[model samples]
Target: MADTYPWQDELWRQLAGREQHAHAYLLHGPAGIGKRAFAERLLALLLCRSPQNLEACGKCKACLLLAAGTHPDAFALEPEEADKAIKVDQVRDLVGFVTQTAQLSGRKLVLVEPVEAMNLNAANALLKSLEEPAGNTVLLLISHQPSRLLPTVKSRCVQLACPVPDEAVGLRWLAQALPGLSDEERGELLALAAGSPLSAARLQEQGVREQRALVVEGVKKLLKQQQGPSQLAEGWNAIPLLLLFNWFCEWAHLVLRYQLSKDEQGLGAADMRKVVQYLADKSEQARLLALQDWLLEQRQKVLAKGNLNRVLLLEALLVKWASLPGQG
Candidate 1:
């Protein structure tokens, strides 16, 4: 059975208690907020021969088959490789599945995660199934970035906005999810994950805190001329490019915010507060804005999985960062 989160209780109630389910549902939210799990739970409940109190009965035949990954009436469509686009041929196969009669003579469920992974052709192919869904079928589409989805695709389904838990709720959940870590450590992890509890737990598992500490120390040394940009860039070869870009992007935002508001509280995480403040004080707003623009452009390339020279990119980023304190 798919495990639901405490923050999803209300949304689950609203969804599971419905008398008539939608033919297709678009569950949209930020990543790592349990939207996929929620969809899985709903799929199980819909396919179960017997459900109790708006939940799936694990003992049922359908539930057993689903648990074993042998359910004939359920289809999951995703990219073959991580971070790759869902091909048009894959969507074509799904269209064929959608038109078939359910083997169990019950409802069929189709789950597509991060629907934005489908490019224009694939998305257009999916529209065929969405337009003419056959028999008792429910399509659950999960999207972390719905703004990238086509307007026509967005219009065909019941759009459901998934909930993002507040900081206090996230921290409480993190306490249970990461008991080995102290409260302060968990708090820092949660902040690093941008307030998503599941993401925070994932970051902890990935040693993100340790990586962050290394990067912070490197940034401080770079500013003080103790470490050169090329050396720091090469030393961070093990860290993910996207993760590095995300942290730098965040720091740039914080610096600009502090420069404008002079709000010390807005300097972001404790590890980089002083660095952000120093940059804010010494860097010109125009230079910072230009750097932000460059970062955003490169970040888009990173997201698109462009063929980038990672070492060169990191070196360029660090060189630009090292120049932030002085006049442009």
Candidate 2:
């Protein structure tokens, strides 16, 4: 993974200087960003008995083992089900890894992807190990929601806030990752992606790609036509609210950019220019900004409630959007 997406020079340098790194490290960022991949690079570094440089020496036997996912010194724990949780039992399992001596006899890196999945009990269980970890054992926790972590756990780790890359950088990188995508498809994929190349790759898969295109297409159609809001509301039954909120936020950004810059060469620029041009002369520009705020708040609300009725929430959002003065 590091081979494809090399660390920025600053990040690599920071990692290199940390001879006595924290026992627990937090890699937090927006969902679908490359936290897991970055964590893997760090894991490879920690486990590498001998490295050629700051990066994992790809030729080393340890690197080969890490790539094969059978590195005895490395352990990764993720949620059992999608968006469910890491239970207490999962943390206890880490206890097992920590108590045992490193199979590699050098260093061990335990990666907990989406550490926010840990329920209260699970977090507490891990806290014990973090407080008194075995020598040479390091805990690397990746999360989309940093605030969800317990304050105690938060204080223990050396935190890395992974900033989302610029949209152009992310899109260009992703366009180069996939081999057979068309220009339109690549641009659309970047538009739908959440600034995460990992997520962007997943969006390239046939089913996911089609769904995202449809979602964006739906938004375009509705926002472009009078009473379009009503049409948008019609499809809310099958859409997830969390996803809808995200889509709306992205759309607003596109519209705002397009309107402000009048650029049509790319996905966001073109779309945003169209929306901005349409509404810039209107008295309701302020209302549109308000709508953007509402969408952002809605996204936060949906994420906060793990059990929200996503479909209903989307429909309600559409209704509100349609009722707005600027909606054509």
Candidate 3:
């Protein structure tokens, strides 16, 4: 994959310019920042027979093999299913691969993406390969949440941190990626993505703005006692649990900001200003803080794969929110 975002130029140069590369590199960054794409480019460049200007020559045999997903010198390990753990058996297969000699004359490359998904056994199983890698072999691990990885695993690789790009750079890139979007829409998407251009583009593609509008509308009805918590929760079953909780968490924080600073700017969402103001005026500050804390806890639980009833959880949360005005 070519450098999809211009902000990655400096990191790409640093990786490409290195003459003596590490045996293993851990690319750690927030989600949707193109860490995997960067790793893929590095893999192709390492395996290319005739690289030019620190880039792989696309016509080379190795490049063609990589493009076709049949490269003899390359291996990629990922979860068997999305949002699932990388099993120990998968890592065991990688251990076997690393022991063998490279079929190609160049470097052998292994890529394990979102390495945090590895369970204890899977992580421990890969330790031996990392400890004593084969000659001319390179391992690249991409992790969105490095804090969750084993300390032993982290110590075995050179750490590379990818930062979120500047806001101006992110907006400019977003405009180019989504030329059809209005400036306001692009800004909203950027804010929603927390300034990650690639993520902002994805949010736009997923129509998160439209979904958020519906959610906000539902919230308004609930707050007015015109809608039941259970009914609203049932209607919102189509939205992902984590996403819905995250959105509510954001809204709660915005309400808190409005209460504290009386500054509407912290809301970030232009469309939600009126509701935010109303909530700030009607809700007790202490209770809002408690709800915010609870929402954060729930969001983290959902992300950690907690076993909870989503519909009931949502219903309970909405019930609390609907009672906020009365409590104050």
Candidate 4:
């Protein structure tokens, strides 16, 4: 298709000025912040045989090949399966491609989305190519968890944090992609999106939107109840850890907004005021931060081979959240 990059003018300008750009670039950021799009656009810029000023000339042979997904010099690698790590064989496959001449005799674009998904052997296997890459073959390494990548992998090239777009930008973009949504629907979607147009777009799908709303409503209900944390935790233990992360942050955002506005906009109608207020008065922001770390630790623990009682973990979180006020 046409090459129209919206949010990355300066990076293009910088790349244009460089006489010898680095071969590897690590694009790291939170999910759906347009890192993938940035990588794709940068790939086009690198492969474009001809460009008008800083933008890729979409009509060129290289651009057309990219559009058609037939660019022999370009490749993309991600985890071959969900929850299955990338093994050494996968990384080793890149060796021949990295060593060989580019199909266009110009630039080869090798993009690895979530380079952190690579196991140790796979990561080390890819090291030689990063150390002695073929002439002008760019490796755009994209990772949500870049810290998992070896320091050697990170040290070799540019690392850029692609932040989320502004709400208005995301809203406008999402509106065009997600038609038939009311202004209210769009607004809620924008809040749920957390400045991510991609996420807002995904929320347009019927089942997903309904599911998100259900989860939010469920969490709201959970937060308002009178039972002890342990008892209250029993009813809803099946929600994904990430979903818990999402809803808790949303609830906290609502409370913070309520604190700021003292209006309907900030109010959590689910009557979570006492619990949230209790935490706000007693807990440091670090305690709030610890929620994510604790959740992740549990996720990895479960992922690696451990069975955690879901209700108990949720109870522990609530009790920790409850008791945070007195910590030194």
Estimated TM-score per prediction? 0.97, 0.76, 0.93, 0.74
Q: Write the per-residue lDDT of candidate 2 for residues 112-153, one digit (tens) a residue.
A: 988888888999999877887886899999988898889999
Instruction: List candidate 4 segments past 4 Å from native.
Output: 2-5, 16-19, 206-209, 220-240, 249-275, 278-293, 299-328
lDDT of 3 by residue, 72-120 (tens): 8899999999988899999998988888899975579999988988989
- The TM-score measured for candidate 4 stands at 0.74
lDDT of the structure predicted as candidate 4: 0.69
Taking all chains together, the TM-score of candidate 1 against the true structure is 0.97
For each candidate, the alpha-carbon lDDT, in order, equals 0.92, 0.71, 0.86, 0.69
- Superposed by TM-score, candidate 4 places the C-alpha of residue 141 at a distance from the truth, in angstroms, of 1.1
Clashes of each: 0, 8, 0, 1
Mark the regions of model 3 whose C-alpha exceeds 4 Å error after superposition: 1-3
The full ranking of all candidates by lDDT, starting with the best, is 1, 3, 2, 4
lDDT of 4 by residue, 1-328 (tens): 3333355456657765565768888888766667787788778877888867766788888899889999889888887887567778888778777877887837788998878888888988998888779777889999887767799989886887766677777777767777788877887776666666776666566345566655545544444454467655665554455555556655565545544565654555334556555555555666566764665576566543346677777777666545455532
- For model 3, name the residue pairs that clash: none
| Residue 278, candidate 3: C-alpha displacement in angstroms | 3.1
After superposition on all CA atoms, what RMSD does each candidate show versus the true structure?
Answer: 1.3, 4.3, 2.0, 5.1
**Residue-level lDDT tens digits of model 1 in 7-116:** 99998999999989989999999888899999999999999999999999999899999999999999999999998989999999899999999998378999998899
- Native-to-model Cα distance after best TM-score fit, residue 75 in candidate 2, in Å: 1.7
